[model samples]
Target chain A: MDKMNGAQLTIKLLERFGVDIIAGIPGGSNLPLYDALSHSTTIRHVLARHEQGAGFIAQGMARSSGRPAVCFATSGPGATNVMTALADAKLDSIPIICITGQVPQSLIGTDAFQEIDTYGMSIPITKHNFLVRSARELLEVIPAAFRIAGEGRPGPVLIDIPKDVQLEMIEFADWPAMPQRECVKHYRKQDILQAAAMINAAERPILYLGGGIRHGNAHDAAIRLAEKNNLPTTMTLLGLGSMPTNHPLALGMLGMHAARYTNLILEECDLLLVAGARFDDRATGKIAEFCPGAKVIHIDIDPGEINKLRTAHLQLVGDAGSVLAELLPQVESKNRQDWLNRMAFLKKENPFIMPGADDPCMPYGLIRQIAALADHETLIATDVGKHQMWVAQAYPFCRPRQLLTSGGLGTMGFGLPAAIGASLAHPQKTVVCFSGDGSILMNIQELATAVEQRANVKIFVLDNTSLGLVRQQQNLFFGKQYFASEYQHHVDFVTIARGFGMQAFALGASDDPVATLTKAMQTQGPCLVHVPIGRNEEVYPMVPPGAANKEMIGGENHASA
Target chain B: MQALKESYPCPPSDASGQKVLELTVNNHPGVMSHICGLFSRRAFNMEGILCMPIGDGKLSRIWIQIAGNSHLDQIVKQLEKLEDVRSAVLHPAEHEVFAKLEEYFQGS
Candidate 1:
């Protein structure tokens, strides 16, 4: 501990923040963190095959654990490779602390080898990025990175430490906290009042929640407000766990891949209250055409999000929980019979669709049954794939932050690490991660990180033996040519799971997969459930990237667009 | 009256499309929304813009593409006077591939 380098000091601080494992790739720049990591018994670094995988694993861990997870890589290419995952963290509002080593402070502006403007490159995707110009600055920057990453409206924060600074001897001073400038703009009383009155008066009020609900820790207040107002609700993909899925008012999801009823009701509604959810291009089909008849009320902790999109008639910029708490008192309870009746009618028509197969193994059935059997407070982290979509459509999540998935960046390998983080954050709660075989392969090495860190995570691999999402796209858009999407040689995922000293279960283990999942959900430690699904499993109701919501493909009928 | 006389001729409708946005970004907020907002609402071809830091903090200088000389001139003047604005200048995009995306939007 005495006279440690900047990397060593920073790693020790991270240990204090409960980081037992770090996913990273070492290079000339981050060689110090890797070097310091060898001498320290508290931190273990897991080397990823790719920087993107490393970044995603960290994102996964942060999302599941509800704590800022750490990742590292060298300058330039390594940093560039991780940009997609970092961007995913930014959009989904995950607390990921990404550290990359720069060439050197003196050589920063120069066209030195492997040097790029990483801080600037990451600015668009990070909650805050710091260029540690001085070695001493790490003391302040490291802790601030954690705070900014985990605080209100959580998102990834990047810290770019120069190689020289990492090696340089630095004196330690107590870390400083970021000064809170009295936000020149807070939600005005009139704005809050106007929003409440509108909500109370509206006949068809629908609450479209987003990841910010969980990020801001506004779950309790949101639940109360929703319940008190008897408001029907729908969430964006990132907003899945904002409220219980089985809650009478829950519309599951409300965008491209959303439930049919949710889409129908949202389109017909007269009043929409957007809480902590931005009308992203992904969520809002076409901006001009989205919710045309509705009056939107935007409430957010960050003012920048207000009126930045699908324009709101009443904008309330303040703490989501605080504003809701104040506005709840001003609200009057009312019912929208026509809206409720239409949602009921549409819900019956848009019931959860399941994959049809002759094989006994069913991923959708298993996820739904497992969700019902699992504890109500359990956390379910998911990777990007077709099975991930099945779980999203099937899983009955009851609590905020219970259903975790990467929305904005849609990183494939996010499940396992995120589940680790969630388990670490809430040890008492059961943590289940649903991943695709292709997705798991992206960062499967993190199983060792989970085992070493004593982070108990249950990983459910929907092994359709293919790049499910891509194959679905190929099937739909690319004329079903079926190029390279298939995983021709199935690597023994069970063996890989056992190699990490995890309890591995196969769907074919017994006559029933639901039993295996139920047992795994009941047990502790990182478990892997290799779910045997069909190779051609396609995610239904998909909004083909830039296509409008009404132009949904698949799910309703398999005849292809 | 003198300024009006000096200004370039423009349709009243085209004038509404020429506007400036002075934003105080959260050190973390992405500018994609701001960019999209301008493009979607203006629905017109844009000229050029500049962005730089005005302060030691997260406050960034984001200058966007404007169309029509007289309209562009008025926007620059008005935007510079916005409270959060440290300084403003009209930066016309000169020889950039993105200039096409601007051209497609600028029917006005």
Candidate 2:
């Protein structure tokens, strides 16, 4: 009379949560979930080579889907392997539900070979976590896991399903659809009006956009307000593509590595329009000195963010889409022609310098070519270090959540698994993971998982033969000692990907890489593109940590070391 | 009378000067998100936020500082009525301490 079994209950829950694809690696304790998954027609399982890769794929999927993605592994070692990605997801605020099969409840903490405290290990990184102690609680827990993972500014959640419990039969019940989501509230209105007045009356009003606009689908509304109110716009790295990059009003990514003109304009602006973007340390260096002369118009959906560390004059608390829809018409047009003209002058005055201009295939040039071939909705995930920053700068994104990189965490080996998640989330969309050689080696075994899953996640390796970021730092700060920075061994990521059943390619060109990337994009199944980038090249416009944004250095090509 | 009044003019001031905002919410799992998400979702500028634990671990108290309020009536109040939010109050401090901090930052 029970609903099939524990595995069936989990499968049913997965269907309910709209999980179409899962990236996982099965083992001793997790066998039952896999057994159930195999029989289930709705949810597809993609086996990863390693647990960490599986975690990243789930992360990628969750970021793109705006829903929790799933990854599975057996207890102990498998669960431990997933820790790095879980922490990475926590920092990026991606919603992924990690389901690991645990040893029988009785075997827990008995020093069993595969027995480990999976729940305790995940508690810190997960927004919420659970340990399914009984088969009877299966239905509630499955839905509960999703509820926690998907709602209220989504983040990762973990569910440790014991092997014995997973195999046991249990009754099923339909839980109510009321998502136990947290209420959304923020600053009072009388004060919000007070803030907006300063902005409307200012001579130079500039809008600094962040990821929230895309998450809220408030892009059009933002543009309407910007155009109507004569407000120029700048985007955060995550906010890239929220507004079109080519728009005359778009100021591009602004911060340490931002265009000199963007930072200059932001510095001189009289009124700063900040929306849906956190004043992360990277974005606003020397916080006190940031926007020194500007009056900030703060609008956000979360109250806690309004004044955690940054000051704003006015505040709004509502979904970006809903609030912008309401307030767009209320904006009064101001003729800030002088401001626009000055910004234009700045843009013309400071052009980015490129490294290896004459060389056929420079790293920056290669990334630009890759971008050109990339679809409007093609999802790009990058590993940590200089390659990640390069992708952030070179990729022209037009969609929200389209680019999923380890921003807050900056974890290496994050790209491939996240690519798996992104690809699984959107089977029709192209998903590319941009990783450095060193980062790829960290979880390269997952290439087998990609082969098994057939998630069509492509990878691009920027092989520079060293820990590029570390080497750069060591060169700049440590007088080029190169301690723990240089790696003598080079990885043949292309061959490795091919051996793991993926298609592979290599490129060496100075101009755009559109043609090669277009070919790669056309391929099916897992693929890897290996590009040998120069080691000395650095991501320029550094703020040197604890410095003001105005203290940025270098153009694209200035010698890093 | 129309309940929605056209509040003319966008209020302007540098809100980054930091202040305290108190929020009361039902004890719930997503309360933190509701508080944090609002800032990210609406493009609000936030600084020095502390969600110090409060009352029976059921109610949450929040302190936030911000500058702009374009959608205060339209958004903030509605959020308060959501399942989690019980009340939200923006406390304006015109005290000498706040004044002194401002003067210190201004290098006066």
Q: Which stretches of candidate 1 lie over 4 Å from their true place?
A: A1-27, A31-54, A76-78, A106-117, A143-147, A150-152, A170-185, A355-360, A499-501, A522-524, A542-561, B1-108
Alpha-carbon DockQ of candidate 2: 0.04
Candidate 1: tens digits of C-alpha lDDT, residues B22-92: 33333333343434333443353445544555578567756464553344433433332222334444333
Displacement of residue A183 (Cα, Å) in model 1 is 6.0
Candidate 2 wrong stretches, greater than 4 Å: A1-4, A172-183, A187-192, A356-360, A509-518, A556-561, B1-108
Cα error, residue A270 of model 1, in Å, equals 0.6
The sequence of per-residue lDDT tens digits that candidate 2 reaches over residues A495-542 is 777788788887764244556677787888888888888788888867
> Model 1: per-residue lDDT, tens digit, A301-393?
654466656667887766677777888888876666677788898777765456643233677666766667777777788888777777777
What TM-score, to 2 decimal places, does chain A of model 1 have?
0.87
CA lDDT of each prediction against the hidden true structure: 0.72, 0.73
Tens digits of per-residue lDDT, candidate 2, B1-108, equal 001122222233334444445666655544666556656655655654657568678777766655443344334443452334566665554224334455456653
* Docking band of candidate 2: incorrect
User: Could you say which candidate leads in lDDT?
Assistant: 2
